[model samples]
Target chain A: MSAVLTLDHVKKVIGGKTIINGLSFSVREGEVFGFLGPNGAGKTTTIRMIVGLMDISEGDIVICGKSIKNDFTGAIKEIGAIVENPEMYKFLTGYQNLLQYARMHDGITKEKIREVIELVGLTDRIHDKVKKYSLGMRQRLGLAQCLLHDPKLLILDEPTNGLDPAGIREIRDHLRMLTRERGMSVIVSSHLLSEMELMCDRIAIIQNGELIDVQTINEFTEQATAAFAFETGSLGDAATWLKSDWNALMMEEGFSVEITREQVPVLIKKLTAEGIDLYGVKAVAKTLEDRFLEVTTK
Target chain B: MGKLIINECAKLFRRTGTWVMFAIVIIMILGIGAFLKYGEVNNPPQVNPAWEQELAMQLEADRAALEETGQNNATLRMFYEREIAVKEYQLEKDLAPETGVTLWSLMSEAQAVIGIIGVFTIIIAAGMVASEFSWGTVKLLLIRPIKRSKILLSKYLTVLLFGGLMLTVLYTVSALVGLVLFGMPEQARPYLAFADGEVVERSMFIQLIYNYLLSSIDVLMLATMAFMISAVFRNSSLAIGLSLFLMFMGGTGTMLLASKFDWAKYVLFANTNLTVYFDGVPPVEGMTLAFSIIMLLIYFVVFHLLAFFVFAKRDVAA
Candidate 1:
């Protein structure tokens, strides 16, 4: 797929201090790309730059083949973004608020507005004032707002900042459906590591205004060797050999060792030959949070 | 641009405060109407049959003063000359001073409320841009597929449109109340205006329309300044406070300064009241209609430059 959004060595300097230091990335068509970072990691700053809310100190950002600096209205027309929170006009009803945005665009229809409202499941409360809405309802209205124009790219900063587990799952499902069915690219930033792992197909990890690495979910968690917990009868006379040879960390039921898949069978046979009592074994999976910590620390 | 203006109007009119403002305007007009109608019904100012004699005496006094002054102060001398000419024309035409509150006179009296309209326009202009940031909706407002210049222009246009609306409301209501209380004059009395050092006869309706527009220049300038302050600083109260302060005190303060310094002609308030060029004496001597118009244009361009530059270039971090 072609790149829908590209950031070529983008830099942001505020008050003579560098905030985003030469960061580069691209969001492809029809993929849910995740922006993973800790607090104050320049995630919102980068999103702002992409949406043309802030100027880039250096480099360029191209959206839908249009450079933001050269053709702002043309580039911005292709994007539907929420820079920070989806701060809406609280005094206006949801429908009126949508009308406010719909007027800014060229040819958004009333049916289109209704379609987006229905898509976000806000049809029941769409006529109510936004000030009466809950946080989740506000998020849904915000989602409806961005979807009104059928944009080529959607950039959501901290999409799940104040959502419950159910709300988060709803947003995840909506994003996944939007990508698969609408053929739209999404750049989502979030502090929820587990949520990102479930929601994103590919994730870029950055820290302290610097890019750390970008990897697919499977590659991010997968390593050459895996850790296994070997449950056995106290290794009788085999404890000394097992500890020295495998560099094992002892656990409550047994000991865990890091080894290859091929070596597991070989070690099992040796343990049986030693006449040691053995039990079932299990493999431990490294979660995205663990990998995030490992990558950020390095 | 059309859609943006419509959207802005919807947002502005949907609020309750806007209706409350209109209500206050209507109520104030009625209150003034009632005060004048009931209080003056018992005794009318008896039209002095000798008013032409009185005007002739005043005209003689003004002519004598003009001869004795001998251009000691050019502006004062001009004022004396214009007064003498108008009084002489009033006597030559056999025109008597308005005896009491008439419909046309009440309509002219209603012009005092234009200052109140100016305050309302200032309030609306002051809050137009800053309220977006304060509500935190400027994030959504600026990210659309429109240029920042167009958006700001639409907003400024809407503020002017609202000012027009309020002026219309004031004019219509005052006319209705004035007609109901005083009724039309028995005969059409032509309004004599001093122009080019001579008194000219003009229709009252046309004169009132001219008065409405010329006085609105003051409101338009204050609203523009308030809009610029709101855009550049993103603070509505500061804009409102400063603009309203100037709205009330600017003329008086400029008058005080015009007495002491010649450069006071360069001040913005001194140039806002363009009516002085047409009928009355200018605050500063040697200040002409062309000079004031040029000064107004300079101030206007400066306000727009500051507003647009700061709005289009600044980082909207919040």
Candidate 2:
């Protein structure tokens, strides 16, 4: 896939202290790329730089092959972003806010505005003052505002920050649909690992202003060693026999060993030949959260 | 750029505060008209046939006083001379003192409302950029395809536009109220001004409009200062507090300093009241309209430079 955004060792320094230290990353087109990091880990800072809300001390950001420093208007024209919480004018109605945003870009007709409002599920409350809308409703309105320009890249910093379970699901589903339908790239930052695992095609983990790793969710989660617990009639005998050739630990009703899927049958046959009746065996798979903790903590 | 300015204007007009401010201005104008009308109905100005005799007596007293002490004070001498010139003109023209209400007098009196408009404009200017940051709407504004300078300029221009709108409302409402309370004058009057060591007659309507524009110079500068503060600090309270304080007290404070020091002429407050050069002398000696204009231009450029530079370079962290 072609890259939609590229950060060439972007750096942010404030008052002699480095906030973001030589961060480099690329977001490919038509993918939901997750930026996973803890609080104060420079996630929002990076997002701010990407959206041109903050200046980069060194290096440059190129959007759609246009450098932000050289051609700011050209680079920014293709992006729609919400840096943090979706804060808008409380005095204006949701539809008015959308209209105000629509005026900022060319060729945004009234029909396009209505279409985006409908897409974000804000058509019902679009005429209500934003102050009267709930946080979830505001988020949806913000989404509607960003979509009015039909941008190529959507950068949302902590999109699910103050959302409930249902709200989070709604935003995730909408993002998925947007990517699928429009072939738009998205860069979403969050501290929630489970949501990232479910929503992102690829995840980049950052810690203390440094990029630790970036990989597909399956690769990161499935790298953990798998283990199997065999329930045998003679647990003691099975543990004794497996301990010589394999790493085995005795349990209350079975013995467990760290092995792959292909080793399960051979171990069972060996157990039966050794006069130990094998009742059953179960495989324990590690979850994404477990792997995330392991990787981040290290 | 035009679209950005339009968007800014739309946002500004949508606020409840903007409408409330407009209501306050209209109400204030109406209240002034009512008070004037009440005064006109209750205590009618007795157009005394002996008004010339009374003016002659006052002039005699002022001349005597001037001979005694005005020689040492240039300001007192200038005031006495101008008063004498005005009285002489009224007597020579056989015109009674304009105690009766007329549309011309009402418009002249309504110019005072520009101060209130200045206050309102200052508030709006102070809140222009600062409120965007406070409301977290700067993120949306800056993320657009426009440059940051263009966005900032659009907001500043909108503030000026709102100020202009308020001024227009004040003029229109006052004109209408003046017509209702006092009938139009029979003929246009000429304003007596002391110029080149002699009394000169200037077109009254032209002088009134010029005075209005001159009075607005201070407002424009104060609003610009407030705009700069709003852009640099991004704190509405601080911007409003500092600019309003300067707007109300800066002139008085500078006058006090001018009394003690000649160098005070260079201060912004001393130079802000361009109207002083219209009918009265400047507070500080050796200050001329040309000098004040030059000083104002320098300050204007500096304020804009600081505001734009800081806004364009500063990070929008919040």
Off by over 4 Å in 1: A224-283
Best by TM-score: 1
What range of 10 consecutive residues in model 2 chain A has the weakest lDDT sum? A232-241
Candidate 2 docking DockQ: 0.79
Best by lDDT: 1
lDDT of 2 by residue, A1-298 (tens): 8999999998989999998898898999999999988788899999888888888899999999998878888988899998889999999999988888888788999999988988888877889999999988988888888888888999987888778999999999999998999999999888787888889999998888889898988898889888898887865555655787888877888788889899888888877778887788998777777787888899
Model 2: chain A TM-score against the true structure: 0.86
Interface root-mean-square deviation (Å) of every model: 0.8, 1.0
> Chain A TM-score per candidate?
0.93, 0.86
Residue B271, model 1: lDDT of: 97
Which has the greatest DockQ? 2
Q: Calculate model 1's interface RMSD in Å.
A: 0.8
Q: Residue pairs in steric clash, candidate 1?
A: none
TM-scores for all candidates? 0.93, 0.91
- Candidate 2, residues B228-295: lDDT per residue as tens digits? 99999999999999999999899889989999999998899999988766557688866778999999
The residue pairs found clashing in candidate 2 are none
